[model samples]
Target: MHPESEDDSLQRHRLHPSSLLFSFLGQAKQFFLPFLLLFFAAGDSWELWFALLIIPVLVFDTYRFLTMRYRFAPAELIVTGGVLTKNERHVPYARIQNIDLKQGPIQRLLEVAEVRIETASGAEPEAIFKVLSLSAVQRMRGRVFAERGEARPEDADEASAGRTEPAPRPELINSLGPKDLILLGLNPGRGMGVVAVLWGLAWQMGLFDGALNFESILKFFTGSEEGSVLGYSALALGFLVSLFLLSITWHFLRLFDYRLELRGDDFLSQGGLFTRHSTTIPRQRIQLISISESPLQRWMQRVSVKVETAGGTGQPAESRHWFAPLIHRHELQGILTTIDPHLQIEQASWQSLAPGYRYRMHKLSVIIALGIAAICQLIFWPWGWLSLIGLLPLFAWATQVESKYIAYARTGYGILFRNGAFWRQMSLTMNEKVQVVSQHQSPFDRGHRMASLRVDTAGAGQSGHKINVPYLPTARADELQADLVAAAGRGEFSW
Candidate 1:
């Protein structure tokens, strides 16, 4: 009674019953927002239509529940079902890049979680278990890595039978408490939510076309003349207040009671308020680790660390990154020790780019800022001169930012990149994740005998998948590219 003795040698199993709840919710989401709008438009009359839609959603959920089936075959994981079209797939363990666990409000309420198994083929997950218990997820994770030569299958034998023997919760290596969560809520990066709200309002008001007057927005928020400092102060305070309330709600729901653990073979995380969750990630599946902080986080002396997998889509809330999202800066070393002793980023001496690197590094940002200043001057006349004053300092600040934070270093495993001024990021990647390394030279760069290194990896989004290190000596860029290419060849690889 062993798995993989033959190509199709295991029993088909249905997901947890809570999966039906998840499936139904997925269907309801399609029409939920529209229903809400209709409710506002037509009052209680929309309830009947909303209830009518529920019937179809229920039917679809039941149909999916009846058809969906997965099998734990040793060599490959198989998923098959479809009442009509007859869909089926076999994802070999060798191609199974990473497995991620996620939970939404409902799934958390039901005390079950979703498991996403990905292959390097694309951003879409290869196998999805909508709802499974913590014990079941641990068993499945064990089975997956067992096939990958990273764990043992007998550990999941209890899973083959129906039992709830939860795996031992590993000892805490690092964690975030209430105070840290509060600081995370107050972090400046969260202010983007308020900015996005204003931008959306402006777009709706036709401000993108230069139709709306800026003074009117100021008047709407603060009833005072443009010359009054109280008017500007009130407006800024209002936005910050809105940002605080929004961020507090979000961070509390997402990171309340957060904890990180290491169970020898993998790292595990569980957190949330109304909707709790448990996530497991095999150590070898990790492609990169990022340690970062926003201006506010830096000011508060805290950091957020994210773990990226080779198969990630890199979308917020959906990506498998951020296994440990936020913690005090001092605790970073304690957690790094669990992941890998060699990944002590604080100990690594990073080599900064040349002092003149900002000539190229700040080129795009300066262009954008100057363009905004020009538009303000054109539209607002004499008053626009004030904007140029602010823009000038910001433009000058870029060089200082580059001098302080922009740099890269070679590591024993791969390249380490440090970038960003306001939202600082430090990424350490292993050679195995690198797919290609290329050198590029711009006309201006060649004049300075400089070039940039572009690294392509599986763990990247369309934009960030290609890592760029700008303003390096041409000889150094060429030499580093050759060395990286050679190292990539020597390292283990998989699709």
Candidate 2:
């Protein structure tokens, strides 16, 4: 009668029938571009070969669908399958980190979703269910969380029985409509990436085979001896405008109808235009939160917020959670409160970098600018010396403005850091979540009696932001490091 006893006695269940279709489609996507290339470039003679390739893929998918079997157990999920080797995996509920769900347009139409089971072990999901009935996924989710003590027994019972019970009312934290998405798209990032992708795609399609010419491009920029600089300037401006528009469209489409909600101890987000994604993160799993603003966003008085959680290191940038893609500056505090009460950065007593940091920043910028100017002079002699006219002032403003904003602080619940001038970012890592605290000193730092402090938490990718506070007085850095190490020792890391 109990859900536990029922699960313990249950037999292994096969994947939903639609899984065969979904698996076949997944394989088809991988070959679609190749098939197109064969048809367009290699001609109809290769059609038979392409069909032959599909035959093996179809057979593989069919065999996998038929062989795969999964079932719920008292304390773990057991998955078994394989052709000859006959592999089996038992994943304990306590070790499960994330249970993510995805549904494409077709899957949504068929009332099925793809499920990814993640753990703290690696970047890839521990297990993936290609296509499962929505009801089955709900049941699995409830069971998993229930075993972890995060869900009620009655909820698990209801889910296991496949009842159409009313869903819980989750409080809406933020919702991004078309206007908000447009605002997010207007942010000054992702343009170069979009341009690069489009250029690559065009190259693959051979759109530039005969139309592009390096010499012609040089001539266009150089123009006649009395070249039309105005004409080339307009052309460059048009290209940049096109790139910006493309970036906007990419962001808009990728995050269409985005919504964030709070359901008890979990933060849930669902978005995407073509393929909807639903991510559930337990509040305790969150490691760090970052709020960032670019020059354009600063002018608009807006900011973007994101969260880093434990596990899944090396995942793509899009896989990271966006707490608020774009929100007004005034709304940040309220959102932070909903995320956690201890993230009150505005109220924290912020500490400025070492007194010599400004001098250090200026010295570094001067060295870089002088190096650039020297290289320019080597190439353009007379005109290159004139580079200091532009470089000096630009570097001066950058160093001075950046030194003014770079700071670190200790919050009631975490350590907070603020850095950058052009693309400013503020990061907060909770004291309890801190895993490692380190201090480093270089020859340059020693010359100025300065050092850098770094705090590492779980799931922090090398490419992503973490709590690294540079340009601190050696004594100050030592003091902060000691405090953080003690705090980390006082609390236990859940993951």
Candidate 3:
């Protein structure tokens, strides 16, 4: 009921001139090509109609551009559009998960940045913003973060203001030199063999049929039959080798300009060759820390570390969104300790399930393998024995890997679930985030007081990471369930 604060008033409205121009230009660009094609293809009679159509479009765009304005209320940002229908939108700042700035080649030439704000709520324009000057963009970013009650450290502000000289940037943190890049590239996952195989399969399946231009290769490789065959084979080999090299080169390049800087309670990671990307993640948002070791990496005693965060595209393509793709495992413990000293992870104690449970799981794998083998025999009788032989090793491997990697760690704050065969995964989340916990007892498991405990968390996608503790004492599962329910009731994440 009191007067509004100055900060509140300052964020009350935003009028981005560049955004209006961007919107108009984007629409104009889209129509321009079609308009040009139509103008050339159509007769003069149709020209009048085109002109008439263009007039209204131009007028409507101009009117919309002139009227566009955004206002920020205490809880949300409001946008109203349309000279007639009057569409309105309310975007809550608290629900905003990410804010990104994009600039295409044309925008770069114009020296304007487009701001995109994405929210947790399911809404179109989950990201909505306008183009603005780089300086204005920076100011707006500061304001948005400020509204969220997260401001840069006092030292950073003072340094920026020239009240105190900025501290020298640490050479190692800011710049990953050629040697560091080489080391990173030498890591096992940098190899492109798997990618190549996938690409080859896609090609064989005719996925690239539409895009293929056979004439170009034919013109280049045409010669005597034997010579042509040799030349084509050599070319294919070279292409594959180049693809492998390119993957390594790209990995190295991504690390080349890598920079991680601390700004208050958050960390900023910035790096890219062609399209520079910068992400700021608050220390508290991290949900889990995982380390993975490939066959080659395990031999070398090296592994990749990743941190899972809340919300965003949980895809490898958007690796930076949910996880930092490549960090040495040895350094993982140190990083987690630095982020949250309270996090504790001990080696999981092996709790063997009932003998019947293991036997059933093993039988299930054998059954699947046998089914696949029978199908292959019907269709490929000549290669049936080989197919069955190949599947035998796979089934054996699956059983062994599952048995070896199956483990769970109980920490003060959360439970750690670890599992995998070819690729290992570990997840940790606080008790309060747990939405549901259930114990499943198969007929076999019921016979020996053994059951799988599945814990589910919120904000995770449809298939959230569910932990299955193969076998736990019923009392332990009940105790954990009670603790989780209490934490949820208190609306807190407790250790």
Per-model lDDT:
0.71, 0.80, 0.58
Clashes of each: 0, 0, 0
List where candidate 1 sits over 4 angstroms from the true fold.
1-9, 25-60, 133-135, 150-153, 156-158, 161-169, 190-228, 314-317, 358-369, 462-467
Q: Please say which candidate is ahead in lDDT: 2 or 3.
A: 2
Model 2 regions lying over 4 Å from their true place: 1-11, 32-53, 164-167, 190-227, 314-319, 374-382
Please give, for residues 19-92, the per-residue lDDT of candidate 2 as tens digits: 99888888889888888778887677746476578888798789888899888776788888877678799988
In Å, residue 441's CA in model 2 sits off its true spot by: 0.6
- Global CA lDDT of candidate 2, please? 0.80
**Per-residue CA lDDT of candidate 3, range 1-495, in tens?**
123333333343454566656776777887788877777778566564765676677678677766666654545666677699887877765555556655665666666667666554443435455666666555444544445543335433432343322323322223355655555565535236677666665655668778974335544666444446667666668667687467668766555466665554455565655445556555565554556665655665555555544545433233234234455556656555655766655443545544455566677778889998886677566776577688878987877887677677666566677776655666666655566777777785666676778776534544333466766556666776677667656766421
Candidate order by lDDT, highest to lowest?
2, 1, 3
Candidate 3 accuracy as lDDT:
0.58
Q: Higher lDDT: candidate 1 or 3?
A: 1
TM-score for each model? 0.82, 0.88, 0.71
TM-score of 2: 0.88
